[model samples]
Target: MLAVHQLYGRQSHAIDSGRAADWAATFTSDGEFRSPSYPEPSTGTAELTAFAERFHAACVESGEALHHVISTVDVAATGPDALTSTAYLQIVGTPRGESSRLLRITTIVDELVRTPGGWRIRRRVVLRDG
Candidate 1:
């Protein structure tokens, strides 16, 4: 769980720095990631990679600096190799030369599994809290 949290933090940091590949590598090969705009899940490594690239491109092109804060991470071990977790997240972004504004505050529910590469996110669902 600690490793998972670190991975999430690193991914967020990479996104903040506009590094898409580093952020995308945090997920499993068959992982599924979903966001409000996605409307459906992005499945598999290729899809996730593309999604991350596009997301980062859009944010950077819009000249926004994204900052993500994650808290209240609660992990429940479902098995020796699987776990479920939920965390509260607040994301803020500012367009270049503009003031920072809240992007979203939500709960991120994740399903993770132990892999050869350590714990990798299998699925992530983001629920808006406010």
Candidate 2:
């Protein structure tokens, strides 16, 4: 459970700090990401990396820093080496010279698997809150 929190912390920091590759590395090689915010799902390492890069580029173009704030995480063990986790995600955007704004709120459900390196996300689904 502690490790899961740490993983989320690292993932959030990586993307927010513009470390695209680092953010993608938190997932498995063939990990999948599905979100209502995006038109299509991103699967595999290459696609995941591209997704992160695009996010960083968008943030750069808009001159805003986007932060993924994850909270109220709920985890359940699915197997000896797998688990499912659900959490609330709040996207906060801070423009270059303005106050931070709440971009959106969503719930993220992640399927994680224990890998030789550590815990990696196998799949993630994001559902935007109305």
Candidate 3:
């Protein structure tokens, strides 16, 4: 559980800091990410890297900083080296020099696997809340 929390913390920091490749490294080699916010699902390492790159580019182009806040994470062990987690995610956005605002609220479901390096996301699904 401690490791899982650290993984998410690192993941959030990497993305919020606009470290595209670093953020992608939180996932497995063939990880999959599905989110309604995106036109298509991102699968595999290359696609994941591209996805993060695009996100960083978009934020830079729009002069906005986006942050991911994960809370209420419920983790369940499915196997000795595998687990699942459900978490509430809040995306807060702040313009270059403006106050921060909540951009979206969503639910994130993730399948995680323990690897030689650490815990990595094998698959993730994000559902936006109305």
Each prediction's RMSD over C-alphas, in Å, is 1.4, 0.7, 0.8
User: What does the lDDT read for residue 49 in candidate 3?
Assistant: 88
Winner by TM-score: 2
lDDT of 1 by residue, 1-130 (tens): 7887887788788766767667667788888888885777888878877777787888878888778888888999999999999998888988899999987898899999998988888999988854
Error of 3 at 108 (Å): 0.4
- TM match of model 3 to true structure: 0.97
Candidate 2 runs further than 4 Å off:
none
- Estimate, for each residue in 1-130, the C-alpha lDDT of model 2 and write its tens digit: 7789999999999988888888898999999999989999999989998999999999999999999998999999999999999999999999999999998999999999999999999999998756
Q: How big is the positional error of residue 41 in model 1, measured in Å on the Cα after superposition?
A: 1.6
lDDT of 3 by residue, 1-130 (tens): 8788888999999888888788889999999999999989999989998999899899999999999998898999999999999998899999999999999999999999999999999999999866
TM-score of each: 0.91, 0.97, 0.97
| For model 3, the run of ten residues with the poorest summed lDDT | 15-24
Tell me the spans in candidate 3 whose CA falls farther than 4 Å from its real position.
Answer: none
| lDDT score for residue 96 of model 2 | 98
Which candidate, 1 or 3, has the higher TM-score?
A: 3
Least accurate 10 contiguous residues by lDDT in model 1: 15-24
- Spell out the clash pairs found in candidate 2: none
Better of 2 and 3 by lDDT: 2
Residue 52 Cα positional deviation in candidate 3, in Å, after optimal superposition: 0.4
